[model samples]
Target chain A: MLEELTIQQKIKYLQDTLYVISGKWKLLILMSMYGGTCRFRELQRSVEGITTRVLSKELKELEVNKLIERKIDNTYPVLITYQLTPYSFSLKPMVDEMITWGAQHRKELSKP
Target chain B: MLEELTIQQKIKYLQDTLYVISGKWKLLILMSMYGGTCRFRELQRSVEGITTRVLSKELKELEVNKLIERKIDNTYPVLITYQLTPYSFSLKPMVDEMITWGAQHRKELSKP
Candidate 1:
């Protein structure tokens, strides 16, 4: 499929994808939610090293992109949670490839 | 495979990959080389938008990462060309996934 496209087209496709998932934190945030729905604090803890402010910002960006959905509950104490939208599942293959490549890269770099 | 790892481990793997390919230009530079070997000037033209200094820097980084090799022909005018290494082929699967997802993403966003 990629071979069919001109190099310019190929680069444009890649640019589109990167524009959505470019930052260091977006993929990490989405990866954490893969387990299940998560509260804001839970996500902050799960992602590790993300400050509350930064996590809040990344979550909003993901929401804007439609990759994740935010749900609010009107209980005595209102509850908020986030989960992956079906649309986001489209990213699974790419994310899997990244994880596999990343792990392999680590091993390659560690070789003496 | 991803399920077997803890979330932290997964994020770590991702971080490792992002650390290397984080910026916009690395993948673009690699993609340009897919056609065949190219000289510095040729690559500058192929990648578009990248300045000479930036392209030179990116090529050096790619060389250091072993994704590309620089061949210098010691002739009247030193013919320098760049080509992908076998190890770089490891990235094909991931790059393909990105292109597929990216193109799909553009279609997804254009929906009215």
Candidate 2:
């Protein structure tokens, strides 16, 4: 199916998925959430160096895209959890490829 | 190997490969070059809407990262050709996964 598309058509089709996961934080956020539902604070800590503001912003974007779902706990101390939607799980193979390719790239770049 | 890496290490490692390919036009440029060696002018035209300045900039960056190589023909017009490096071929599976996932995402989005 992929081979059928011209370069022009392929680029146009792929841009949507890339837009959903292009940022420095979105993939990292998704990777962190693969462990299942994580509280807002858990995500903040797991994705190191993300500011609370940026984390919230990325979360909102992911939720808007339906890649993730947000659940707010109605408990004594309110809590919120973020989890990857089943739809987002479709990205597993892409993430796996990135991991493999990324490892190779790091090794290649490390050569002096 | 990927499963062994902690999420922290994974993100840190993946960023390098992502850095090389994350822009709006870099992947498009690379996709265009999948046809084999192409001159600067050919690429400029193949990747629709990429201005000459941006094409030059992205081409230089791809060359710098060793994903693509540039060769000067030194012909009457002094042609320059760009080709993907063997190392960059490691990204083929990654690109395939993106094509598949990207197609899926587009289909899902088009649904009412």
> In lDDT terms, which candidate is top?
1
Residue A34, candidate 1: Cα error in Å is 1.3
lDDT of 1 by residue, B1-112 (tens): 7779776787888887887777889999998898888999999988879999999988888887789999999998889999999999999898899999998888887887
Q: What DockQ do the predictions score, one after another?
A: 0.73, 0.66
Q: Per-residue alpha-carbon lDDT of model 2 for A39-96, expressed as tens digits?
A: 9889898888999999999999998878999998898788778899999988888888
Compared with the true structure, all predictions reach lDDT values of 0.88, 0.84
List of clashing residue pairs for candidate 1: none
Give the least accurate 10-residue stretch of model 1 chain A, judged by summed lDDT. Answer: A1-10
lDDT of 1 at B102: 92
TM-score of chain B of 2: 0.92
> How big is the positional error of residue A32 in model 1, measured in Å on the Cα after superposition?
0.8
Off by over 4 Å in 2: none
Tens-digit per-residue lDDT, A65-88, candidate 1: 889999999996999999999999
| Candidate 2 docking quality: incorrect, acceptable, medium or high | medium
Every candidate's fraction of true contacts kept comes to 0.72, 0.60
